[model samples]
Target: MERELPKQVFIDGCEQISMEFEPIGFRFAKSGPHASRRAGDWAFKISFQSNYLNVGGEYVELVVHASVYSKAIKEWDERSAWPASASDWVAGGQLGNLRTPHHWRTWNIVNPHTRQAEIANIVANIQTTVLPLFERFDVPRKLAEQVACSQVPGFMFPENAVRFVLWQLGPEAAENCLSYWVARLPSPDAFRSERDVPTLPDRLALGSDTNNLARVARAMKIGLSL
Candidate 1:
């Protein structure tokens, strides 16, 4: 009744990307098995919560694989071991012994049809999972508005099924959030919105869609009181 997992999946996207995409690729807080795959059916799921947000979603049936001709990295390796062997920095020829990288890992999100509805759903899931987390982290409302405005691209399916996406926010978005906001580093003002706020779902369909990243940035800037 179900297909088996593919031998492997390939990610397609910018080879060297920023950290803005971590929210979509790696799980932040919530933890569970990565998406499952089968032979006839191509399905995957990612569940992670930024200290600021939590997201969970699934693609029912799609053609999941690494990019055919793109330079992107899949979540796992040929052996399915994350944090690829080469991923580790070689400082002084030592492994796992070096300053942490600047940003989180990246992945290219792949879908079957690359349809607006599908992209909308993925973005919606991101918004559903992340907005509240950002709210929780006191990310400026304005910055959030900006991000929401340009979350998805207008095009066909990416070469890879679910490769990395850029996670690096513009300087404006990171200013009030992290000291070295390029990565997951904490923000001096990150906790400003620690107070009660809307649930992830409520925040997903919030505003008229134009005020998301901007409002989020603003909220983070002044430490909006949720």
Candidate 2:
């Protein structure tokens, strides 16, 4: 009897999961462990991660991730050379993190006998948790709103968020978004001590003397000053 390669087992598992995902507009890549769907200028993706060591044996541990991307936002950010944090996708996190009262979750596929149940659990999480979240931000404007409010996961900085709003909504929405963050800035006196200075993420989001936020605003032609 020929022993099955672990990679083949993983691919077979993905194929089973693909059947559930395909009807919902997601297309699983050939011989790949991810599926993606396109909606106008945006793309939604679900990717799987597993330990490399498991590839040599029947045991595999998997973590699933869901993410969204915007072609418009990517183009605008690239054209302006804006310093949005590096990420292939615009929004989303691990499937577990996005769940209510969030807790990390992983699947262990120990053998063929147990694989069906594990696959079912993973598919159910995507259907119940991931799909609804993706549906909520189906349009560009809705996604921009979430990004502007910093409610979207994976968009870590307000500067990037506001820029995304600016591109998708307009200068007024961008200005409104910037105003909220600008209002949260600490007074100059508060930064007299090194420890008092806000951290890098905060400073970038809130516009420090380095003026990253202001630079983005100018790049986008928004009139707000830091």
| TM-scores, each model vs. reference | 0.18, 0.69
> For model 2, how does the per-residue alpha-carbon lDDT over 120-183 read when each residue is reduced to its tens digit?
9989988887888788775668877766655455444556567667777888888777665555
RMSD of each: 19.2, 5.6
* Model 2's TM-score against the true structure: 0.69
RMSD of 1: 19.2
| Tens-place lDDT digits, model 1, residues 1-226 | 3432222111111111112344444222212312211212122223321121212122222221110111122222233322123221100111111113312322222333443354354344434443333232233234333432322221011101011111223333334332222122143233333212333221212342222322333433322432
Error of 1 at 168 (Å): 28
Residue 144 in model 1: shift from native, Å? Answer: 22
Q: Cα deviation in Å at residue 152, candidate 2?
A: 3.4
Q: How good is model 1 by TM-score? A: 0.18
95 Cα displacement, candidate 1 (Å): 34
Model 1 regions lying over 4 Å from their true place: 1-111, 114-116, 139-226
